[model samples]
Target: MKIELIYPRWKKLEGQTTFHLPPHGPVVMAAALPPGVELDFLDENVDPRDALAACEGCDLVCISMMLTSQVKRGWALADQLRARGLRVLFGGIASMLHAEETLAHADALFLGEVEGRLGAVLEDLAHGRLQKVYNFMQAHPPIELVGPARRSILRDELYHHKGVRMVDLFHASRGCRFKCYPCAVAYLGGRSFRPRPMARVAEELAAIPNGRLFVVDNSLAQDKEWEKELFRTMIPFKKTWCSHTIEDDDEVLALAAQAGAWYVYQAVFDTSDFIRQRVKRYHDHGIAVEGTVLLGLDDQTEDSIRRLIDFLLEIDLDLAEFTVLTPFPHTKCRDDLRKQKRILSDDWDRYTAGEVVFQPKHMSPARLQELYHLAWETFYRDEPQSMKMMKLLQRAVARERALGTYRGRRRDLVRQSFGRELTDEERGV
Candidate 1:
């Protein structure tokens, strides 16, 4: 049997550059496929022109319905592949959001983690007993059984630009313990944090050839012991990686830096001085900090949004990603908005973090959206073009050098990664 797995590009606004990181989902799921299957993987965001090519000569074509930004394209791609007489499968976050519509497109829908389910699906396919929908949410697949992602199957060239690969993605843990309103993780991966055993995590890290990684855990702050041990275990690997962490403790932060933490995705939800202090601490420890601003929060006004941007500049954040407070399906935020009649649209495309889809508590939704756009514009606008490009180049060079991963094609990939060629983020980051 043959299988083709795909992770599609996320559609974003014009002028913004995207660098496709190594996708964690499709690679991880590919690891679950039983042996002797001819496996192929495609990252549509990089070379979208030939995304459909991966389906050729495959027994089963699987495309991830991963995010709101990708669903529209994901559906169309799945339908097109199905027309080619291939059996199509849909899975991931978006599948949970648009299950009914998704089911109509694919031959089967594999819901939630495939740990305990893929074997059955492959077994059934062999015996001709496959089902239309396989929901493994109830199984709560044991974290111990989570296998190392089959990273070797990826087309490395597709991930590199100008010479450096942006980042390799992996998760030391699954699910989020907190039920934040705008989050879809709790419903999808359950509210509890399920971490892979430290030994398994170590083994996986050793196997991944890339030194630069993007740890996809929602937050490492939830478990101090696990976070500390994770970094400790990673020290031997000598890998420099980044991930989201609200870990405020000085000791924990120090340990992470010692383990080669390049940076962390720190959420700046308010204008509190604590935010300033925390960012400074991260800098003090030789770790860069990228701020994630959630713009459509009830407390934010036009002035507040601008003020946050100013604060980000003042703190000299490494980078900032500004997004509207999206109320996604099965999230507490969506339920609350539905009750208050604040949801403006259920149209999945608009659910991209850049667009506002819900009514705000203070300002008009349009105003919130304006601020969101302004934040991105103001962010890059305030920085000189040369400085922006220089910073981008420096970051790329440092990561590539640190990992010593890519060779020969470095200069061109680095230049392209910086948008020297005017490529809109075809896919990634």
Candidate 2:
């Protein structure tokens, strides 16, 4: 059987540098498909026309929706495909979060992790006994069954920017132990932290052909020992990476630095000394810090929001991403806002973190929206995100050079220029 795996595109955050990092969910799902099935993976972000053409000879069309913003488009794609007599399957984080609504648009909806389970779903498809839903949300397979992602399905050339390859996405674990208010991960992947065995993680890492990666675990801080071991396991690979928060302990941060941690996205909710120290700790370990600051929280007054923006500048974060709080389905934030009848919109498209979909306790929704843009403008005004990103790239390149994995042509050009004496014009004389 043949399947066309489609990762529907969504609107990126406004004012952010637009780049597509090869997605992890689709490639991982590709690995879980039973052998002998021809797979064509299409990321619609690159080209929607090519994804549309894949429907020609495919036996099934599978849509993977990772973000809430992507669900509307995913539903539309499924509706279009199913109209032409092709079967459609929905899976990934967004699918689980919006299962009831998604089910209406799909022939079969596969919920939860696909490892050691998707084969049966395929068997059902082969026998004309496909069920309406394959719900595996609570039945996470043993972590050992997780294998290397089928990254070969991706068109490597299409995932680059300015001739530099984008980082390939990888994961060493699933689920988050903490149930943060605005996050749906706990409901989607459970509150228990589920880590893949070290051996399996090592296997996948070794098999990945990219020299850089985005370690997409929900949060590496869940288990200290596992987090440290994961870094140790990764040290020999000499792969530079960035990820969400890591354990704040000194030893864990040191191990991560040794393991080629390029930077990390850490939450900077307040201007407290503890938060300041946490950013400093990561920096002291030679890891750059990217602040993921969310505005419009119940505790944040307009004055406090302005204070938080100034605090970000004071902390000297390498970069900062500003997003308004969004109430995604199944998250605690959604429940509370729904109860208060303050949710202004149920349109999934506006659920993109960049937009204000609910009333803020301390300010009007319009005021909250204004502050959101203000946060971005204020934080990026001095250094600008692109320049900051270039600095991070320089760090990654230096790290790669130290590890003997540097392969960029620009590095060779820089070395040659330094070897020769510069003329007057070149020296800006």
Candidate 3:
């Protein structure tokens, strides 16, 4: 059976530049399909028309999309594919959260992780007995079952403009242990960390085309022992990699750097004076810590936003990603925001973490939007002569050079300033 898997793109907005790549979920799923089922994967975020065309010869189509923005486009594509007489299967965090709604359009909805249920779904399809829903909760299908995903699947031409020759993505673990108010990880993978064996993970990392690695684990240092094992195994490669980590362990940070982790994405939830000291420590370790701050938490105020921004500037971190507090489906923040009536918009497309979905307790939505832009402008606006920026520029240049293509792409709604603060359109209450 020919199966086509798709990842959709959101509508474009002015001044926003989106980094489009095939998300890890569908690619991992494709890796898991039982033998004899021909597979084609499409990341519509790169080229929508080509992705849609790739679906032409497939008997079955599977789609995975983000919950907030991509659902509308995902549903539209599924409906179109269904109309053309192809069996449509849907899954992803979005589908898992809104399974019944997604089922209205899809012939089957594969909820949760796709590894365990994928084979059964395929088997059922072969016998013309496909089920309406397949859930693979807490099941870790063997890594070897899905043939190693070739790095060639991502176009070499995409990274050319930045001068980076190659990039490869690896998944070392799944789920998050912390119950961050705005996170969707706990909802999808539960509040526990399930790491693949260190040897298995290292082997997969070794298999990728380029030596450059991006470990897609939510938090890499949740388990110190596993992390130590991983670092030990990776030390031999001496290849530079990037991953997210919490701010607790100095040993783990040092080991990660020794293991070729050039970039560390660290979250500074509440920027206390103590946390500021930790941030400085991370920078002192020769690791380019991209310090991130959440702006719309319950107690966020303008003074707090400015203080956080000032702290980030003071720390002289390499890069930063500033995001509003989003209440995604199945997250504690979502429930809390619902209860507090803080959600400003229910449009899933606006929930990209870039937009203000919930009203702040201490500030208006407009002020929040202003602060969001201010954070980006403050960090990226000033061109610095520091080695960190130089290194980031080098990496960015290398990445662009490796991809070999450049186009003037505009930013999306989330990246733009709101002319007027928008309110929930669905509410007449």
**What local distance difference test score does each model get?**
0.79, 0.90, 0.70
Residue 35 displacement in candidate 2 (angstroms): 0.9
In order of appearance, the predictions have TM-scores of: 0.90, 0.94, 0.85
lDDT of 2: 0.90
Clashing residue pairs in candidate 1 (N, C-alpha, C atoms within 3 angstroms): 18-425, 20-428, 161-413, 162-412, 162-413, 162-414, 163-410, 163-413, 163-414, 181-333
How well is each residue in 1-429 modelled by candidate 2, as lDDT tens digits?
999999998988777787788888999999999899999888888753566678778988999999999999999988888888899999999999999999999999999999999889989999999999998889998888999999999976667654677898999998889988888889988989989999999999999878889999989999999999999999999999999999999999999999999999999999999999999999999999999999999999999999999999999999999889999999899899999999999999888899999999999999999999999999999888889999999999998997799978433233222223336564456
lDDT of 1 by residue, 61-175 (tens): 8887678878878888888988888888888878877788888888889888887578778787778777899977646788998878888887776677666666789889988
Q: Which candidate order results from sorting by lDDT in descending order? A: 2, 1, 3
Q: Could you say which candidate leads in lDDT?
A: 2
Instruction: Give each prediction's root-mean-square deviation over alpha carbons.
Output: 3.6, 5.2, 8.2
Q: Write one digit per residue (lDDT tens) for candidate 3, span 164-268.
A: 333466777777787777677776787777777766776776676555567778888688988877887887765667778733578877777677676778887
Best by TM-score: 2
Candidate 2 residue pairs in backbone clash: none
Worst 10 residues of 1 by lDDT: 418-427
Q: Considering summed lDDT, which 10 consecutive residues are worst modelled in model 2?
A: 410-419
Error of 2 at 8 (Å): 0.6
Error of 1 at 208 (Å): 1.7
